[model samples]
Target: MAGIFIFSEDSALAKQLLTPALELKASLAQPITAITLSESDAEELAKLGADKVVVLTGGTWAEGFAEAIYSQISKAEGSILLVGGTLRGKHVAAYVAAKLNAGMTTDAKALKIANGKLLATRVLYAGLAVCEEEVALPAVATIRARTFLAPAPAPAAGVVETQSAEADSRITISEVIPTGDKGVDITAATKLVAVGRGFRRKEDLKLAEDLAGVLKAELACTRGIAEDEHWLPIERYIGISGQTVKPELYVAAGLSGQVQHMVGCRESKVIVAINTDERAPIFEAADYGIVGDMYEVLPLLTAALRK
Candidate 1:
């Protein structure tokens, strides 16, 4: 029977994908099938709302199961497949799309079924524009983290099944060296303090860090701070090519809010900007603006929040 399928290597993101999958299920009247590498995730998905949970075991790496995942979906004649939008997940999703000869959408912000087609909304041109893509059935799409909240538990849990799948042996495992930088998942942060090029030096970041600490928020940065200056980890960067966030409070400090940067945090519930230049684009996007040096503003804000 044709059904809607969801897959993700990350357990949390897998659950998030269900939000859209459930919506599609409501519109298409198809059963929901969730595929995962973890048995624990299968149980969670089964409880959450998936009509069926297929646990793909025996794969050393999640990406290696792409072929197996495609096989299962093809055998089941799944009408639509939603994959988690992580780097690893994207790789698996693309491979499966190719094997199925299906159209795929990446970083899809929204999804829906209309007139027997899967319509996905996503940003285009370095976040300069928004466009909707309509794909024919047997469609595939990748959704980023925090794009949707996990659906509440279903009235009744779904069935769980297991399938043995071998990992691709083409690439052998070697040493796994950790990057050592322990950075939190900024996309999942409720509040964020994003720093940009406006800071004079890396040491100046301490000011922003102080503010974040007072607000109990995570530290985020523009691409330059992370990539160019190396003041922060790459994972902390927020831009068109970086992490997108929808925090309850977003404080952009010393950052010129270009489209590339704003695109990532524009959906924030409340945006506050502190830039010396009044003409900065960040002010236009922010819900509140303070025209002054972030160096000056951050200290004052932190002091006030601390009291």
Candidate 2:
């Protein structure tokens, strides 16, 4: 039988992929094979419901193992391959898809096997619309982080295998520099305080920061705040071209709700918008809204939460 496969260099994301992989396994009647670069992740995936764990060793660059990953799936007669939606993972997924001559989808919000075809749901047109794509097997798809929770431990651990992969030789690594202290992973944050261009001055961001502190939430921003104004790091920006987050509580202060920005956090469990303009588009998507200046509202809200 053709198998369902999963791959992710990021250990946490690899495990999370298993949740949907297991679901696919049930519907496709295929075994789940999880591909990883870490032994620890291999073991965890095996326990989480992977029928087989393939640990790719001897690879310094993850993207270098694209051909190897394709080979493994081809050998197993894999019908579907789900890859993590990280930047590196996208490169690997695209390479493998080309090698397999298979159709692929990126940032799929949901996946299912229907009529022996892979159906994926994702946002489109800079988050202005949603669409479903159906591709024939052997299909490939990329899922963003926090898309699904890791399933409970499996009833029985699956088999584990190790294989050696060759890193790409064309690229030579001379030096490795680290981007130190880039704050929290906002995509994984349970709560987020997002600010947009509504804030007049960079110093006024302290208001949002105070509110975030009281809520124990991470601070996020629109593209303008990060890319143009340089108020926050680019990593903190949430949009179609930026991080997509589904936090439990999303507080939007001083940001106009544009389809481009809302597309990233529209899936948030609860969205609270604080904007001076009652007609702002953000209110339409918000679970709650306050028609008042965020500068004035944030302080009162933060004080209330503190009290």
Candidate 3:
């Protein structure tokens, strides 16, 4: 059985790491193992059907962390190694693959093992397309976020293991910054209320905020809101270069619905658009569209909701 390592964090998205590992195991017909930070993490990995869990020492270097993973991989008797596309996962994959001289793939959306070899698929050309890749050498790969649809089937044997770093190294975490949602990370939020250029002035943001409060949804903004007026942080922008969200509900206020913006939120389960322009592109994709001034409509919606 091949060993698959998932770089995980203690966050709500922890299960996201398991999806690719499970898929890799199913495709390869092998046992998938997980490497985590602590014993508590090991327990959670077990619930995801990992065959083995390895916890590293506190002072492990990034290279040392790579070495720890390689050591376990050497003993796991697995030919292929798979990692999630997270930043840590990418760094470890590159470091370990270089140390081991194995081929590597990044941002893989689909992965498989065919004829005892590794095959990975990724999207390219601004996510408008996809391509299949074959890593001829024994290698490590990093997968993209939210690509794996389902977790691997469960009820497999879980073996907990404690392993030490191959090299004693110094690691210091000097700073920790939250990228999304200093107030609210819209991408991570289950529900979102997004504002667009149709908002006109910064004062108009209150209308969107009020609606968001009424719906108990996080607030998001388009590039115009950030670049044109500086009403929101640039990090809060949602587009090809900014954050992507697939919330349970996405409400767009005063947005003209540009194609560039629409692509980012296409996966939203339910999209409700409020724009005075009936010809706005957003209406085509929105499940519900209201053709009216956001200022006029928002108050009515909020009042009804509050009632």
Q: Residues 1-307, candidate 3, lDDT per residue (tens digit)?
A: 4566665443323456677667667766667677776667677677767777777765534434776777777776556676665666677778778767788887776677776667788655655566887886466777656665435446765888876665534565667766543665567788888899887778889988898898999888888887788898877777755677899999998887776677678789999999999999889889999999988999998899898
**Tens digits of per-residue lDDT for model 2 on 1-307?**
3999999998888988999998898898999999998988888899999999999998678898898899999888899999999988999999999999999999998999899899999888888888999989999999988888899999999999998887678877788776523657888899999999889999999999999999999999999999999889888899988888889999999999999999889989999999999999999999999999787889999999999
- Give the poorly placed runs of model 1, Cα more than 4 Å off: 177-183, 300-307
Q: Once superposed on the true structure, which residue ranges of model 2 sit more than 4 Å away at CA?
A: 180-183, 188-190, 300-307
lDDT (0-100) at residue 134 of candidate 2? 95
Best by TM-score: 1
For every model shown, the clashing-pair count is 0, 0, 3
lDDT of each: 0.91, 0.91, 0.73
Candidate 1 lDDT over residue span 1-307, tens digit each: 4899999998889999999999999899999999999988888899899999999898668888999999988999889999999988999999999998999999998999898999999889878899999989999999988789999999999999998997787977777666624656787799999999998899999999999999999999999999999999988888888888889999999999999998889889999999999999998999999999777788999999999
Greater lDDT among 2 and 3 belongs to 2
Model 3: residues with Cα > 4 Å off, grouped in runs = 10-16, 60-64, 70-78, 97-105, 114-121, 131-139, 144-156, 166-173, 177-190, 223-230, 233-243, 256-263, 274-284, 288-307
Clashing pairs in 3: 2-78, 181-184, 181-185
State the displacement of the C-alpha of residue 253, model 2, in Å, after optimal TM-score superposition.
2.0
TM-score of 2: 0.89
* lDDT, candidate 2, at 173: 74
